[model samples]
Structures are given as structure tokens and as C-alpha cells.
Target: MLESLKVLDELRLNFSQSGLFILNLTLAFIMFGVALEIKFEHFKKVILNPVSTLVGVFSQFFLLPLITFLIAILLRHYITPTIALGMILVASCPGGNISNFMSSLARGNVALSVSLTAIATLSAIFMTPLNFSLWGGLFTEIYSRTDASGLVRPLEIDVGQMFQTVFILLGIPLVLGMWFNHRFPDLTKKIVVPIKRLSIVFFMGMVVMAFMNNFDYFKAHIKYIFLLVFIHNAVALTTGYSIASLFRRNATDRKTISIETGIQNSGLGLVLLFNPKIFPPDLAIGGMAFITAWWGIWHILSGLGIAGLWGRKRKRVVTIQ
Candidate 1:
């Protein structure tokens, strides 16, 4: 499998410059929609009730990436370098915007979910790059010594460029949307739902475009990608829940943290991967692209599935009472 997957290092996805622009815009728009739901009150909630929020943040930005690196190391012989790095990148991303919806559906703490999302996004401008660089660099360094195949390239990422890209993509829109929401409360309320719904639609369209453009590559390698993502995502969800439980959090908080940690901002990962400045076009990081792209679709399915099960379980408990 590792030998077969080596071909992914040389495979390039069919994304053009214009498509990259659209993807960036779509991600920005989604972030803006996410900001509409955030307010000063959410931050205040964090200040007053910091335990769960901090746990969620720690679980996501700290533990997830570390766990992913360990998983990559354990499965080193079973996976390629790009695939391992792809998992690291996704783990390094912030929680997904859709997690709030899934949390609500699962009868979890929606306020905590939103708070975690806002905090994670803000922190991601720094944490994403830091975690990815730290873990990715370490992974390559460790494996390069043992594997003489010359496949492991040094993780040569421009931290300054990444910081700039993350700020422009996430920071600016987040500030603007939050400001707009603060200034016009009534309008924000009226438009937030539609914008959130539309953002999800646009993001799904972006995923569809990615699949359409690289259908053949995805078709050939999706089996391996699927299994890797499945295990990785399950670990993420478990990490969140286990951390929350270890901290003695309530059931709702456990659910919220689990969902938040499980559903990563793979859309952001896609944008970063496609950015020529961050990752040049000539670099054959197709495995990274495939993992990031498939992750965007799979997490949604997994999140919703888990949320549905939790919802049904809650309803059954309520009936018994």
C-alpha cells in the first residue's frame, strides 16, 4: 500500500488560479457567516465559564495535532509521507463552522460550541501554522533518518506567508462580520441564518467542484484515503470526549467538545493547500489535497451520523422518564 501510494506524491489536482480565488472567497464568506453568530456575550461566556471552553480549545489545538502525529508515526509503514502530512494539516485546522449546528442537533451546548469555534478560529491564525510546522517538521525529520527512499522532503513552509494568508482569509473577515453584527443587531439576526445556510451550500459546491475536477485520482485512491480519514476522525471525536470526561465535564459539554474537535475546518485546509505561496504548484502534494478534500465531505457525514444517534438516544431517555 505504501508503494502504491507513492504515486500520490507526483499527482497534481486540476485546480486553476481562478478556482483558487473562488475557494478563498468561499472560505472567507463562510468565516464571515460564522462570525455573525459570535458576539461579545460569547466571549463573556468564556470568561465566566472558562473550564469547558478551555478544555475544548486545549483538546483541539493541542491534543489533536499531537495525537495525529503519533498516529502517523505508528502507521508509518502503512502510509506515505504526503498522506501523513495531510492528516497532520487537517488535525492542525480549527473546528468546523458546521459543528455548532451538529451540537445543537445532538442537544449539546450550542453556546459552548459557538464559543469554541470563535476562539479556535482566532487562535488558528497562529496555532494552525505552529502545530503543523512543529509536528510536520518533526515527523519528516524522524522518518527521513530511517527511510532512505528519499521520499520525505523537509516541510519547507514559509511561516510568514502562512500567517499572512491565515489572517487575510480568517482574521479580516471575522473582524468585519463581528463588527457588522455588533452594529446592526436586528439585521444580523435576520440575515445570519440565511447566510449560514448559503455558506454551507457554497462550501459543498466547492467540494463538488474539487471532486469533479479530480474524479479519476479520487476514484483510484479514495479507498485508502477513506480508511485513513475514518480512523483519524474517530480518534479526534474520541479525544474530545475523553478529554471532557477526564475533566469531569457534563454530558452536554462532552458532546459539544466531541463535535467541535471532530469536525475540522478542512475548507481552510483546502485553501491553504491550493495557495501557491503556501504550497507551490510544482510540489506534488496530491495526497494532501485528496485527504483535505475528502475530509471536507466525510466529517459532515460522520458528524451528522453521530449527532443523529445522540439525538435519538436523548429522546429515548426522555421518553423513559
Candidate 2:
């Protein structure tokens, strides 16, 4: 498994500067769409009823990264250093923009979901870089002592560059979208749905293009990647639910918190990974790119699958009652 995964360290996906620009635009547009759902009331809701929100924020920004580090440590022999760092990067990302949709489908707390999304996205500018550097640095230090191969690169990140990228990609769009919504309520309502639908199509197209370009590498190594991502995603979802439940959150909050924590903004991770300034073209971090890209696709499937089950179970209970 480690030998197969090691090949990813030398691999580089075919993505042009133009393609990268488009991805940045698409992700920014998606963040804008997410902000359309964020009313001032979402922040107010979090402030007024902070328990569930606090639980979700804690689970996402803190516990999830901690758990991922522990998982990487425990599974060190089974996975490569790059793969482990990839998991850490994904964990450090904020909740996916689609989590609100999944929460609504699950009959969970849509308001809370939206609120968490807003908070998480805003928080990510600082937290993503902080968490990744903190955890990635620690992982490399610990792993360096165990491995004789010297594969682990010094985990260096330009915190200023990352903050700038995230702020541009997330913070600016968020402010603009919310302001547009606030300024033109009627127009915001008319365009939000179409913008969101278009954003999803564009993002998925990018992911498919990435896969097509790297089909051979993915085909050769997807089994290992698949299993790693599947287990990692499951642990994330379980951690969210278990923590929420431990805090005595109700079922609705539990479901929403779980979805929020589990569905990470891996698109952002991909964008960061592709940035020459942040990751640099010389870095052998293809494993991080693969993990981030696949997580973008897999989380949607897994989130929808779980949401569908929860939705059906709710219908059944209602019928029984």
C-alpha cells in the first residue's frame, strides 16, 4: 500500500494557469452563492442560541484536526507521509458549501447549518492555515523520527500567502454576496438559485476534467486512495455526531453538526494545493492534491447517501406515529 501510494508523491496533475484561474473564479462564485443564504440573522442565531453552534465550531476547527492527526499517527505504517498530510489538509478546511443542502434533505436544522457554514467559512481564513501548519508540522516532526527514507519535506507554509488566498477566495466573495443580498433582496432571491446551480455544475466539471487528465495515476492508485478517503470521511462524520451527542445536542442539531463537520470545503484545499506561491510546483505534494480533489467528489456522495437514509428514516417514523 505504501509503495503504491508513494508513486503519487512524484505525480503531477495536468492543470494549466488558465484552468487554475477558472477554478479560483468558480470557487469564489460558489462562496458568493453560499453567502446569499447567510442573512444577518444567522449570526444573531448563533449568538442567541450558541450551544449547538459552539459544538459545531469546536468539532470542525479543533476536534476534527486533532482526530485526523491521531488517525495519521495510528495508520502511519499503512499510509505514506504525503497521504497523511493530505488528510490533515482536508480536515483543516471549513465545511463544504453543500452541507446546508444535505442538512435540509435530512430534515435537520437548516438555519443552524447555514449559520455554521457562514461561521466556518469566515473562520477558515485564519484557522485553515493555522491548523494545517500546526498539525502538518507536528506530523512531519514525529514521522521524521520513525522513517529512514527522508521523504517528508519540511512542512513550510507562508501564512501570509495562505491568508491572502483564503481571504480573496472566501472572505471577499462572502462579504460581496451578503451585501448584494442585503442591498437587493428581490434580485438576490431571483439569482441565488441559478447561481448556485451553475456553480455546482462548473465545480463538478473541473473535478471531472482533473480526473480525466490524471486517469492513469488515479486508476493505478485509486484503491488505496479510495479506502483511505472512505475511512477518513467516516471517522469525520462519526466524530461530529459523537461529539454533538456527547454535548447533549438534540437530533436535529446532531444531524446538522455531523453534516457540517463531515462535509469539508475540499475545493478550497485543491485551490490552495495548486497555488505555486503556497505549495509551489516543485513540491512533491501530488498526494495532497489527489486527496483534496477526491474528497471534493466523495463527500458529496457520502453526505447525500447518509442524508437520504436519515430522511427516509424520518418518513418511516412519521408514518408509524
Return the top candidate by lDDT. 1
Candidate 2 residues 33-141, lDDT tens each? 9999899989999999999999999999999999999999998888888889999999999999889999999999999999999999999999999999999889888
Question: What does the lDDT come to for candidate 2?
Answer: 0.90
Q: Write the per-residue lDDT of candidate 1 for residues 98-214, one digit (tens) a residue.
A: 999999999999999999989999999999999999999999988887777645446776878888889898999899999999999999999998998998899898888766866
Least well predicted 10-residue stretch by lDDT in candidate 2: 149-158
Q: Write down the lDDT that model 1 would get.
A: 0.90
Candidates in order: C-alpha RMSD to true structure = 1.2, 1.2
lDDT scores in order: 0.90, 0.90
**Any residue pairs clashing in model 2, and if so which?**
none
